[model samples]
Target chain A: MVDREKLYQAILTGDAKSARALTEEALKESVDPKELLDKTLIPAMDEVGRLFETNEYFVPELLISARAMKSALELIKPLLAEKGAEPAGRVAIGTVKGDLHDIGKNLVAAMLEGGGFEVVDLGVDVSPEAFVTAAKDKGASIIALSALLTTTMPAMKKVVAALEEAGIRERVKVMIGGAPITQRYADEIGADGYSDNASGAVALARSLAAKVPAAA
Target chain B: MPVSQPTIPRLEEFLFGHARCPVTCGNHLEIGAGTVIPEVNFTLQAIEICPENWADIREQYSLMIEDLCRRAVELEVPGILFEFETLPPMTVNPAWGLEITEILSETIDRFHQSHGLRAALRLTPNDTRDHRRPPRMRSGPFWEGMVEFLHKAPHAGADLLAIESTGGKEVSDEGLMNADLKKVVFALGVLAPRDMEYLWGEILSACEGTDTVPSGDTACGFANTAMVLADRNMLPKVFAAVIRVASVPRDLVAYRVGARGPSKDCAYEGPYLKALAGVPISMEGRTAACAHLSHVGNIAQAVCDCWSNESVQKVRLLSADAPTVSLEQLAYDCRLMNVAGQSREDARKLRDWLVESDSALDPQAYVLRPDVVLRIASEIAREPTPYLQTRRAARAALREINRAFEEGRLRIPDRERRWLERLAKEAEELPDREEDLIAECLPETSRETFLPEEYGLS
Candidate 1:
């Protein structure tokens, strides 16, 4: 039997090669893919998030660990799908129009993915219409918007309006985060949620996902 | 006398220099050599289409400036420095940008001539490369637009030139978020200074051609990013404080490349820049609440040469236009500092109050104290290279933070306490040579985000 402990350590330390090798080994030993994911990969990513919140691990660390977890996850994803497994949620994320800043948005997308969500990254300088289109097409339960500039922050409001116009406002939750974004701004813009940091964003997404109704 | 050309031969001269290095601008206004100048930074509520609405856009800015200058005259403020930080659309269209620049510069000139209330216009083009990954610093349309404006704005009557440049921000954004020291070093220490050296060379040539004062650059995109993140509890405050210290050497490159004093107001690291570079630094504190909230509300003003309200929109307020109200608040702040500076003892008293009020509230504010700034700056100046200076600044800040924590002057949660030790160890373990540090961090960096060749890395 494979030493499952090494897989957890590999993911924790962001050793993608070792994480991939170990996950593959665990599977060959007839280990359950769900068991490996629930017991090892998710726990490792959860700990990474915890360390991030505590300031022991920063974005670089979070990014590398997320990479490692994804590497192992890629190997297990097909098998999990064959077994009829489901992701925690589906999320659509993008940086709002006129703001080309993507580092923060990317971090949130990575964190949401690590938290077991199926994320559709919309890239930087995204328009409200594109976000609305993505929500409708991907059947995303949540739309994550980001903006770094005070000038571009208004675009976040335009997105909420677009969602309402698309008649998806009832089903799709909107969460916003960025340097200039505040809880007050989120409340004013009618966003369903706001998270100051990437780690908090994952928890916010999960809670919102729990409250969301199943896709029609 | 206001020096026609300002130059400092070495870093040692700036050790205790404050209000001793001045840059004369327009006809009569002198900043830093002595006395504080109030620089008002204002913007329209929103930018609309150009040519189609250039008339309205021009009128909006004209009214804001007219209101600001009238208030300056009424308040009996000695002088004003107006910074026109162009929004994206303005810079993208150089003709529209120059038209607005001409109007603002001509207006300030008119105000100075009529009221004898000396004023200078600082035109800061919004760095357009912000939208590009692996940024195109020396070439591309954004670069072309920026360079064209640099050459023409001075001729259009812009008296000073500066930028909140975003050269290394691609990696810097990632580094600050993850507490990644090596990435931070590369972004600020290596890439930023190199970009500053090149960009400021262009700025200096422009300044010489048009006789404009080459004002300094700010680590706004780099250090300020760390600060905003820390403020939101996304990163450790100590890391943010250390990043602020680390940014000094990077900002100093502007002076090395011939940028004269009175660096941008929003550069919160202005105090350390003033101490180490001996430049007149403009700083905004509580009054800048119009732009963003900050914890260093009082301490940021302790060593400033020019006081400022970062940027306020020209919207209606209960009492007056937002810019007018901001000017009143800033003018009062400058008046108090000027009155205090009339006597050495009185200045010290006020400086102490400014430091003590916010220093203990957060580590980010703590590092901005003049005494702390000098200590960290002295360590930075001793280093022979920008990379070493950046490393030394980070270590020195961590040292001060540790001492503060140990002495009970600052508080640290258990999580932050552990992080402080880890950061101190990490700072010490970083490669002693810049080459080795670069070699190690290169492979770790994502290639798609930035081009290593742009930074002269093979």
Candidate 2:
């Protein structure tokens, strides 16, 4: 059996090689990949995320741990696929039109992915029509819109309207975020949710995904 | 043993007194705000130095000035041209003009002594015409105060004093008609031939008088009246006043002209560029100028603007590349370009091409910072998939390491601690890559190239 303690240590220390080696060794010993993933990798990452959110860990540490988790995941993915393990959910995201800033959107996207969501990121200056099209095409359960400029805030409302007009507004929850965007503005625009930062976005996405019907 | 002061190399030679163009048109002088110092953004560069914020100013001002002087010297640019202004302290009333002048005189002397740099001081008297809460410049009192201030300027170590014709309800036409340009010029001409000459002669009896540029208004817009003087062979006096203060080499006094607006203004655009081209002077415009010409977006426009200008042979382009470019590469290229000026054109072209080609890989193209990977991971954590599954797994590992460090499970060394300190300082202002920080912490010889996988970015 793989040493779960050592695997956890490797994850915590951001040791990619050790994590991969231990994960592969466990797989060879016929240990369930999902069990190792859920117990060791997920828990390890959850701790990392908590630390990051608390300001205890910074970008470098976060990046290193992410790299280690990636290597370990590569070793276990085929086995998980064979076992028919499902992902958390699907999401569509972009920066609103006329706004070229994307750091906030990118951070949310990274955090969402770290939370185990499949994100279709339509890059900056994406029109409302483009957001709706991407949502429909990807069958995304959530649509996250971002705008950094006060000038570009109107673009977010236009995008939400476009989604409503497409008759897919009810199908996907729209979440708006950015530096200048506030919860009051989000409510005023009739958005399903609003998050201030990347970590909050992940938590919001998880809650939104839980509300979605399994059949849909 | 006394600590030795660092020697500042005279990168650019001052020609003392020479005339490149005997007859020159009026040029636009940006005053009120400071000169756009080298390296920093235009807005920050032009901010007024406030004594109230002196602590912050003291932290960066010396370094900023040193950098600016070094760049000017290295680029072999002519002497610095600056518009000097003093705001009455919040605690003091407007009647303390003498005190304000004394404070300003002390500050200017200290600035010059510390940097071994002198500046042309254009003194604008307070406008008190409006009966508002704070009285502005009253035309008569203003000129009288300036003349008094000029009498004491030489003793305070000021090189030259020019009258600023900026204020009043009449100065709104964007032309010299409303401004006090003619009055200031006449005053200089009248006094310069008599009392001013005696005062200046006494002030600089040890040095040559040929280096001075005669006093004139800090012209707003393309001063059409000043152009008329240039046509009449009277520009030599004004140029002499400038030379007295700055001692600029004749070949290096680049006359820059541009429209005054926060953004692009069509009405001013045509006239401004036309005036610049007519004056046989260099033109300085923002990103809009290049964006309009190149029809490109973002940094590409800025790069093209600075590079396309034949006059900007010694250009310093800011934020030219996305943060995704390796820090090591960026720093290396910056130093390399400074050493060898020939690579500017090629570097700009390469940068433009890189932006175009890397548009797709830009996962968070909406944001300019390079921390998009973090966002992607967070999203994937909540909604998993085959495509994002790998990314989520990678982010998890990164988070784990972060957690360990936070919990004090991992101990960082002293050398690495210093590196982290520097990184923390830099990151407070700007977001940067962790791998880059790690590399920076390492010894110069031991520093390794950052791999995307090493930081879970891949």
Candidate 3:
């Protein structure tokens, strides 16, 4: 029997070494990889997110803890794949065309990954066409766009319009955020959703993923 | 976002152009101070050099710095500021960065010893423009490097350590890229405790941070804030706020915003209008106008202008010399004084004198000093303020009753001194005038919104 509480503690405190050792030991004892993720990693990240909202934990803590969780997840990823474990959702994320701001985008990407989403980060200054192609190819449930500048906001609108021209508007949920983006602006640009912060972005991604029709 | 030279204000905004200068760019050498009149000009910006050229660039940078220092002294201006930031490929390597810092520190000591220039050097933890940093500074390695740089640089000879983040700027229209210490850096909840030769300045250009992207205190992220908070706990405080964003974090060592700035109009105009009824009454902190390419002498003139002003000088003196009043309370008092028909200059002097008088005399008795009487008398007689009608009444009431008293022209009986005190109280306690004027100037009706209710109590 695995000390599940100890595993949870290791993940919560961001103890990557203990987490890795525990996971390897748990695997030898035939513990379920999906169970570890669902019951341990996801729940720990949920607490990290909650702490962040309450101001008890900040970005540095989040980054370090997420890294710790990743250390353990790397060991479990193969087993989960062998067992055909489904990710919570697939998210294709990028900073829109002509906007190179990525701190916010990267934070959301990491948080989404911690939230059990398979993220395909398109990096900075990604074109509208690349986003549409990646969304279809990756079967991403949510297409997350980030822009830090007001000048690049029109690019976010263009990405959404590009998806529509490609005939995939109905299937994909386009979520946009950045310094200049507001929910009203999101609606104006036809994006499915907009989040102000990374934690909120995670919550929005999970909600959107649940609403995404199950893969055919 | 890119910090492009704005569309407005052609570089030829100056009264006279230097035809023989090597550079052709229109220049306004703006510093962190202001220009009082049309004759005042801007200062040269702190220059930087790429890391690969550290060895080679030293001669060029040194000669420019030496010339600038010599000229600054001749102009009687305060020392200049320059920085050595981590550039990609050459300076990012920790050992290399530390070596450059060591060399720079030695050079700084030599300059001070030789030229008596009070030039300050800033150590940036991470350059948001450094593209070569590991993607997202992966696994907080970026922060680790910064921490190492900070620990070693001060020992090497830095005058200041600005926990700077450029956020992101465009090199050209070619691409939009943002890099930050936030990517792979952790704001250590704990700062390295050290000797206090240097001060910390925050340059977090985060006026536009959204909910997801919190630029902890305007442009400064968590690392800078955490360090500031830590310094607050340490003895002989070690931080100053140098913000470049829309908002200013409330701190005692603050260089606050320009009330009207960055508009496409003038090269860079600050809050105080020189023609505000011919009385310069702004309590706004020193600010430089924008002239993207200014000469060294121009910035020195602006600094000189700001330092020459009594209001600016008084604020600097109050912050540095006196410990009785917090700067926030002083600013609050200035707002009240400005409303009460006092020019910003008199207000600062009064506040400084009040604190001095408060500390010197018996706590119970308020004795009128020569400094206090003369200041009040001069302010009452100075001008007819157009801001409010009650301002007129407030000035008139004090002027009528205190005219003889201030100049030592009145002979007061011992018993009648109480009556003179009563009239003085009346001048201060006049109805509806003060509350209305202060409320009008405030951003919010409840002062608690702009600052904490118990702001200076601590």
The candidate with the higher TM-score, 1 or 3, is 1
With a 3 Å backbone cut-off (N, CA, C), the pairs that clash in candidate 1 are A58-B178, A59-B178, B262-B280
lDDT of 1 by residue, A51-105 (tens): 8887677566788899998998898888989989878788999998877878689
Q: Write the per-residue lDDT of candidate 3 for residues A63-155, one digit (tens) a residue.
A: 667777888888998998899887888899999875656667877898888788889998777889999998788788789999865546778
Candidate 1 residue A73 Cα shift, in angstroms, is: 2.6
TM-score of 2: 0.38
Off by over 4 Å in 3: B1-458
Badly placed stretches (over 4 Å) of model 2 are B1-418, B421-458
Provide the lDDT at B171 for model 1: 86
**Number of the predicted model whose DockQ against the real structure is largest:** 1
Candidate 2 lDDT tens digits, B231-326: 222222122111111110100111211111111111111111111111111112222232122112232221111111101111235732211111
- lDDT value, residue B310 of candidate 2: 8
The lowest-lDDT stretch of 10 consecutive residues in candidate 1 chain B is B1-10
- Taken over the whole model, the C-alpha lDDT of each candidate is 0.83, 0.41, 0.43
Better of 2 and 3 by DockQ: 3
Q: Model 1: runs farther than 4 Å from truth?
A: A1-72, A84-86, A127-142, A154-175, A179-216, B1-18, B46-56
Query: Which digits, one per residue and each the tens of the lDDT, describe model 2 over residues A137-210?
Result: 87888889998655467778888899899988777888999866899999998898898766678789888888
